[model samples]
Target chain A: MSDIKILQFAPFESFVSPTFWHKLAELKLDYDRLSDTKRSIFGYYTNRKASGCLLEVDYSAYNSEAQVPKFSHVAHGNIYNKNTIEEFKALDKTALLADEGKQLLDDMRSGRALSDASLLTRFFVLSFADLKCHSYYYWFAFPCPLTPALELLSPATKLKEIPNNGNYVEAISVLPAHAQNFFILHVNEQEKVCEALSLTAALSDFDEERAQHYIYCFADPSEYENPAWLMRNYVALLLQKCPTLIGKSLKFLGLRYDQQMHLDNSLIWEVRQAEACNYEHVQFVGWEANRNGKMGPRMANMRDSMDPAKLAENSV
Target chain B: MHIPNESKFRETGVLTPEEFVAAGDHLVHHCPTWQWAAGDESKTKTYLPKDKQFLITRNVACYRRCKQMEYVGEETLVEEESGDGGWVETHQLNDDGTSQLDDKICELTLDESKDEMFTIENGKRSPLRVVTTDDDNEDDDEAIDMDTFEESGMLELVDPAVATTTRKQDIETNPSNLASVVNASETTNSADSVLRTRTYDLHITYDKYYQTPRLWVVGYDEQRKPLTVEQMYEDVSQDHAKKTVTMESHPHLPGPNMASVHPCRHADIMKKIIQTVEEGGGQLGVHLYLIIFLKFVQTVIPTIEYDFTQNFNMS
Candidate 1:
């Protein structure tokens, strides 16, 4: 037991494009004046050609129906716009994370996550846009359940090292865009073939006799050695939906692709998750550390860029 | 802002929206790194196809500042020493002092160094010298007085408070000491050694008014933090940094204005390049428009290492 290593996951780096702030400003003045409500927003992550685990939000993030870019998966989230700086600073971060986490666990147990795997990648943003000054203060949180810690049974292996990986890659490529993010891969060792199945289909066809053939796969956005934080919730979702897999060693595939859509960098790990005696009370963690790595908010001073008067002054 | 009556890409070098799409598809086919993005659905242009609204390439690394490049020529070396604002400007003038399209090609052959600079090998060119001539009058609006010039120069100095804050943030964010390791190696002056650099997300959107493609840049610092407009200026060629690059709202996205290369002179430059090609007995196709556009935009941002696959020849 001492020889086994605990699995670690890289945190998501929030990339807020300038357009997001501009849109927020527009909303504050025109639509959401003095109303500090949670607005539905969505961010995206791409498994292809990423240097780090990133959650990117642009102007289109405000549009729920915006088309997801090629080779990217959408993570639906909400933005809590605070009216004042003091209100933003005074907000209870712990309770906020807990609320979001409880929502995620509920979704998992209710089969909502199974229907839409994107729910497993839930996130939220807390912000205060100083429209008058053109400065915005914000923080991001990628809520993840902390129960049922997964441990690596052995060192991770590259997908290329596994036999018949080409078949697995080929099958995964044909999956619909929605299923591409999270799915199950079944490898028939005797026949030397592989098949990709949607989570809903795989859950319906779960067989304990052939459980050994099932391999959980996810589109990993992290370029680091460790998997991305999204895997923690994914693991929780799997345990909540299928309790029989608890305490059983399973093969997990971190499906990463390059600019050319090649799976040369994909990694495979043998992981085991211990059962949580108290499943009702699952703890949640994951508030993104500020630029200082502390539990705080970061500020962006856009006065020079966003302020029309300042821009006019600079043009001279 | 004059719209061409007909598609005169091979003659006048002005491109219609259809021609822009054709050229963009050609660029994406050759250079897989460049992709067509639809941008905001609400902001889609009626002229462009829905999916092919604009071209974008992200995380293009700019390894070093333009000042760091080794200037080989005596004239450019003198220009470098004059001041930070003193960027080399080359004008290909005829023997009679007139700037003509035919004479520009002749002048390219006369100057061996200039010929070597424009030589495209494996889609890469040598560090560019800023080329501006009397014909580029559209940038006249960017001309600034001495007071504004001096104020911008002073703004380049690093503030002590900001420096300390950045250092503190670096220490706090990087718990594994990975950033320190990268910082240590970056201080070395060796050309081959790893250097902490800035990266840019380059976007090319077709301008209907000018009937040409305009370039926009969003840059990030070494820490991947969004760079301020002043910080982005460091990566741009000094000559064009003030004159050509202007902060404006993106056509397809509602952003607090991004730095864009004005498209006023794009048609004129394209026309000149087309004439030069025709005079050399080679016809310039509309499909190759973006390749040439990317090649010439290097003068505005010479350090950005964006990939533009050059399988074809340009004489």
Candidate 2:
């Protein structure tokens, strides 16, 4: 490969229809945050192979193909939201997928062709009942938990029902430098504030600066184990990926924070599973969606005569 | 099957103007539709579809607001005090040129013959770029790599496309592989095997309205934790709309041909909204007014049968 100075570098964010989970990462995602055309859900390439910190957007919840999302294929399985794949199937029964699903699976395992969900959906109607699968990972976007924000509030965590912008489920903060600094400062402030108000300090003659540093440094508590402190490091790692955001990611990160967020205090975020990494392969078995080594009762009734085209096991 | 009453408020219960505004503030940050708004307090309103107006009265400001707690993470660079020298922290540089694959995929366009397909010959999985040296010089060397993928169990997308070459004999002299004519539809095999990845999406949206402007309940966290008003604000502003909008979902609001009930038929939408509000330290209220909305809607159209499923699933 010829070497050219990379003028600008950025990490791209892609949200694909669960129907686009072709072999992990082989998706078609648009680079623009908001485009005139519909977001072409690109299959994900495993982070292992693609390398780098990944901002995963998992729509397995929509996999039921019955759970209608307000838009796109995310509404798949929804009693309401209509999807392109569903519309296509409804329009034509003998489409490419209807006849080719079984064969597609056969070649994928053999490493001949990559696997995709749209190609698989043609194996008759899909109901989670027909397949077996499990969650590999998840992201949570939530509100940034802060104590000051709670002052004039209720006691129940579920008191309020919805969150605003800053509130996210799960955000991976990655700015380690800032995180580390904040941690130290926060610890120092805690100690200093305590010492400042302590009546005991009047007699002990505590040195304000030294006392402040003690809680932060290893001056006291020889066996200090702080999980919250450790969690800070993870947040730092997530923040480190801030520059790579695109699409909804900008909404997830690039947005400014008026103040710092504390731990377990925000909305959970969308999660991405390592599909190929976990080696999870899902296929339909007689009107039921099935995964590796597991099966569920087909949602199809006997009178309907449901048969998901099956390829030879271990064919691909 | 529909009514267009933008000014219809307090059609049922007797909520004071303050309570109504406070409730709007809660839903603006807690409701999904309320997340996108423009302008500030005094006139906070969520931009939404004209039909879904029931959100206005959905909020029932509880006497008690939720509590919020959090674990503080790291801040910035640490300052040494023991007369120790200042130390520098290391950071991995952003992704670079070789990392972006625009030219790679674009060049794979079809020519005349279909034989010459697109394929990555080598370096498909580039090494993850990291910078450990505290030195300021070589910091711009980080590239997106596939290092931590194994542990997270999310590594499976980095494969080089390998195209098969086809030999051809043409009218001119020697034959060559082409991109055109290659059966875009025809498969070398009878068909292609498809692999579907299971996706799990947890959407936490805060539709906010800053009525009673001074304070408002945040929202219910998906993890069952409490979110604060500030946190709720942070979550909402993170979106493109960037405004404080009120929710108006009701049992039955006015809209197109006999639309379904707001809280019942659109159960997931409401559940997500309540969960968002609960996560934000906002109080969850019963949609008693939904029944009122239905009664009123029924009075307008006597034949409309209300299908109520008692919307549960809120925190």
lDDT of 2 by residue, A47-71 (tens): 1111121122232231212222121
Docking model 1 quality class: incorrect
Could you tell me the C-alpha RMSD of candidate 1 in Å? 13.0
- For candidate 1 chain A, the 10 contiguous residues with the lowest summed lDDT are A289-298
> Whole-model lDDT, candidate 2?
0.21
Residue A139 error for model 1, in Å? 2.5
- Name the runs in model 2 displaced over 4 angstroms: A1-185, A189-191, A194-316, B1-6, B10-315
DockQ (model 2, Cα): 0.02
lDDT of 1 by residue, A92-119 (tens): 7778888988888889888899988989
lDDT of each: 0.72, 0.21
lDDT of 1 by residue, B69-166 (tens): 33335655676566423331322222234545334433432342244432331124232212212212321222211112111222232221110112
lDDT for A215 (candidate 2): 19
lDDT of 2 by residue, B129-196 (tens): 01011212211121011111112211122211111111121211113212111111111110000000
CAPRI rating of model 2 = incorrect
